[model samples]
Target: MTHQESLYGKTPDQLAALCGELGMPRFAARQIARWLYVRHTEDPLRMTDIAAAHRQRLAEWFSPALSAPERVTESADGTKKYLFRTLEGHYVESAYIPDGERATLCVSSQAGCRMGCRFCATGRQGLQQSLTAAEILNQAVSLPERDKLTNLVFMGMGEPLDNTDEVLRALEIITAEWGFGWSPTRITLSTAGVVPELRRFLDATKVHLAVSLHNPFHEERMEIMPVERAWPIAEVAAILREYDFTHQRRVSFEYIVMSGLNDSPRHIRELTRLLNGIKCRINLIRFHRIPDSPYFSPGDEAMVRFRDALTARGIQTTIRASRGEDIQAACGLLSTRLKGGI
Candidate 1:
């Protein structure tokens, strides 16, 4: 028997096409969108707007296509890490962080990462599988605090640009009028400058962008992030400079401040020179040390000095707070240990 199609994460246009195949009217797509996203219904039978016969047909051939987090761990600081199992039976993690009135969810785009950044734990698992649009959206759709989430960040488990298509689809459903209808400004997709796809992401969506620039110098960055060899950080900066981010659309650089590695005056001067013309902020994140990792977190004084130095150079810089550290929810700590045959 053929497997039924999942209705979750499909765009309105895609749903319209599905409706055509199901012998339903085009308007049925919007109705389904309203039920699936607006109403957050997980069962076809509960869609009261659809006729009984149509609902029956839906139950037979279409599924609501949502998966709840298999495991959740809450940190002492109120950050929560949700472990989700993908269709491929591999696992990924999503982190929900609450800060007063603002809350953000860090969602994954792939089961595991392939970028192999030295400082990242997820990369150790290599590539298990690329997650579907439904899987990417499921993290947010199935969230207990979905209503309280003010922002979403694609900075969890994988290189978003590497899994560009599915990430793009999920983004469309997130910001589209017929879907969740979230503002593009509230979403940020971080990448280690996967140049070609990064350019496509800039052209395709108005959502904010964050470049992972741990080191300002070329050689040093390549040591940690192999992607730098393919798409140099300078080239990424050049491409970003071409885009207009003067208004609501913002672009920021994520700099994980490693104690003595990239927190020096020389790196700051080079960073200022590299991002000279680009209108973006620098978010200095403290490196969360992983097992067998050579990198160490910068002291609070060093982090503050780094932030102050960048600010003095006319770049808006802020030290991002470390959250969920006790639960291994900080940067570069998300992994299912899938490579360990778990």
Candidate 2:
């Protein structure tokens, strides 16, 4: 049996086109978008505002495209990792972090990752498949805390720019007025620098950009992040310099400080020189050790020292507070290896 196409991720324009093809009234497109996004309902029967005949037509050809997570593991620090089985039977993970008055949902853009960043668990799984836009949006739409979320991050399990088309569609649905109506500033996308797609992403969306610049030196970065060989971090920074980030929209670098790896004074000096013209902040992340991994987080004092040294160089830097490490949901630790049960 063939599955019905999903309606949940369609933008207003796409929905309008769909409605036209379905022989429904044009206004029905807006109603369906409101029901799918604003109301967060997947069942056409729940769309009370749409006419019965039109709703039936919608139900016949399209589904709401939402899926509840199969399992959840919560950390003592109020971080939760949700395991979701994708439509293709592959599994992915999403991390929910709740801070005072601000809750961020980090959603995955692909089932597994193609970017084999040495430190990232997701990349080790190899590429399963890029998620459809519906699957991407469902991470937020079907969340139990959907209503309470204040921010969204595309930093979960994949190189988002590698799955640029679907990721962009999901972003459009999240921020469009006829959809969730969220401000672009409320979202951030993390990438390990896919230069061509990065250019496309920067041109198309106003969401905050976070480049994974774990190291400043080219050869050294290539050792940890293979994307550097194809699209150098220096070139990524050069592309970023073309954009205006001194205003509301911001660009930040995610530097995972591993002991004896990337947390040296030379790295700091090179970082300062590499990011000289860009007005941006550096987010120093504590490395989380994965199974058999050689990388280790330098303790708090070293992290603080590194942050201070960068700040002393006139670049704003802050250490990202480690959360959900106990549950393996923190940065560089997300994977679906245990998704079969967990």
Candidate 3:
């Protein structure tokens, strides 16, 4: 016999209809939604308030789609990287960093990636599949410290813009008052500036944004990130210019400083010129070494000089601290491997 679908992807109202179809009392749907979303109960069988027969029907027909990491590797610096399996058995990675009072979870939106930013580990893996809404939610819901999380970032595995529909749906579930109910302020979505969808996200949500802009010159950026070929950085900035980011919301640039590459004074001057009108901060990231990658992290002196140059020009800038370097959980370090099946 075919089993009834679980209520995972269903909204509170959709789940209500599911309860009626299962021959369950109507009120049971709201209770179940509360149990799954608010109470976070893992076992439907253990919901004792419901009548035993009704509970059995609910349990047998619908199964929860929660997840746990198949394997976890941690760095001594309090950084933990996880490999999670999707419903279809495809693997994805998320990272948790317990830094002081704030704990951040780097969530992935796709199984692999299609953006093909040459410096990114996920891009190297290639796009295997786009994650379902359930798969996307599972990353946050199944985190070991779900309640303690202070921030969530879509910076781990995929080009969120390519999977725009699912990413936005997942964001709605995250920010919707009836779902996780998280304030949009607590979430930040980074993109390589997928031109069209960037505006859609801005129009729909107030979540913060970070754009990957390693080099100001179109040709230079295109050399590292293949996405530059299609959506030029100039066009990305033009769209962003249409929006006001002076207050409330934030916009930042992610510039991975590679030694000897795009870190010279010439590049810096061009970068300053490129970002002159844009009211955004620049975050200098230390590029993590990966096989066959031509980039190398800049030395400490160079990093300091780079930050100072930006500061002198009245641009706010800071070098992002390197975390989980030992365990490969730092920026551009998450890659899924075949292991024990989930």
Best by TM-score: 2
Assess every candidate by TM-score: 0.96, 0.96, 0.90
- Model 1 per-residue lDDT tens digits across residues 149-211: 999999999999999999999999899888889999999999989988988999999999999
Candidate 1 TM-score, true structure as reference = 0.96
Q: Name the 10 consecutive residues with the lowest summed lDDT in model 2.
A: 1-10
Looking at model 3, which ten-residue stretch has the lowest summed lDDT?
1-10
Poorest 10 consecutive residues by lDDT, candidate 1: 1-10
- lDDT by residue (144-225, candidate 2, tens digit) is 9989999999999988998988999999988988878999999999999999998899999999999999999999999999
Instruction: Output the lDDT of residue 329, model 3.
Output: 80
Tell me how many clashing residue pairs each candidate has.
0, 0, 0
lDDT of 3 at 204: 88
Supply candidate 2's per-residue lDDT for 300: 91
User: What residue runs in model 3 are displaced by over 4 Å at the alpha carbon?
Assistant: 1-5, 16-30, 42-61, 337-342
